[model samples]
Target: MTVDSGIQWRVGDALEPITLPPVTRLELIQYAGASGDFNPIHTIDAEAEKAGLPGVIAHGMLTMAKISRLFSPYLKYGWVRDFYTRFVGKVFVDDVIMIGASVAEKEEKGAETVYWFEVIAQNRKEEHVAVGELTFLV
Candidate 1:
């Protein structure tokens, strides 16, 4: 949702996991078109392979967007102050990924409540493709 939403989250709340549909070159291209991150490694298979990747790969931002989708539904009306992430592995077309997150900690910073979050995206092989932390203002 929008940033001005109210706080309904708690320290131990768990978000329902989301399984991303199989990734595809078409999907990556669509995201590139939408986000304007037209990295050759994401759209050109040969370039990606020549760079030592298996094939054309999904954008890290695109994967992060999927992670964001998983968070938005549970956090409800949101106030995400900061999101920090790292791409641990490349995700290729046809890989099935699941996104999950849980509350890692909580703190009261004067008038704001900050929920520390841990997020992970795992492929069908159960490999962590991306790991992230998010801080939300409640």
Candidate 2:
């Protein structure tokens, strides 16, 4: 891919699917300690089960970060100008997350180009955990 020209061509029509490592209890605990998000549902199995979750769950942000990294190659060094998500379902331990993104549109209003994106994360059973839009300025 080339960058820094007067016009930046669309890098791709669709990105390769990104698959996250399986979610696990130890990973959740480490994420809690590292991120300071010590919610019981993410750290206590009983609390998660009582809350109708299968077990201590991974933080939503942890999953989001994984989704974010999937696009790093395309965005390069630029930060996402607009990024937002809707939580569709919970992710339990051992569930694998599959991330996918496609270009919805591209607009060139002036010197800057705006990439409208669609992204989703799903489990092996095809249940979506999170879905969202991200815009990048090119």
Collision pairs in model 2: none
Task: Give the per-residue lDDT digits (tens) of candidate 1, residues 28-121.
Answer: 9999999999888999988998999888989989888898886564465547788888999889999999998889899887976778889999
- Please give, for residues 19-110, the per-residue lDDT of candidate 2 as tens digits: 87888889899988999998999989899989987778778898887778766875654557887888888888899999987788888877
User: Which sections of candidate 2 miss by over 4 Å?
Assistant: 1-12, 75-77
Superposed model 1: Cα runs more than 4 Å off: 1-10, 74-76, 109-111
RMSD of 1: 3.7
- Which residue window of length 10 is worst by lDDT in model 1? 70-79
Q: Total clashes, candidate 1?
A: 0
lDDT for model 2? 0.82
Q: How does each model score on lDDT? A: 0.84, 0.82
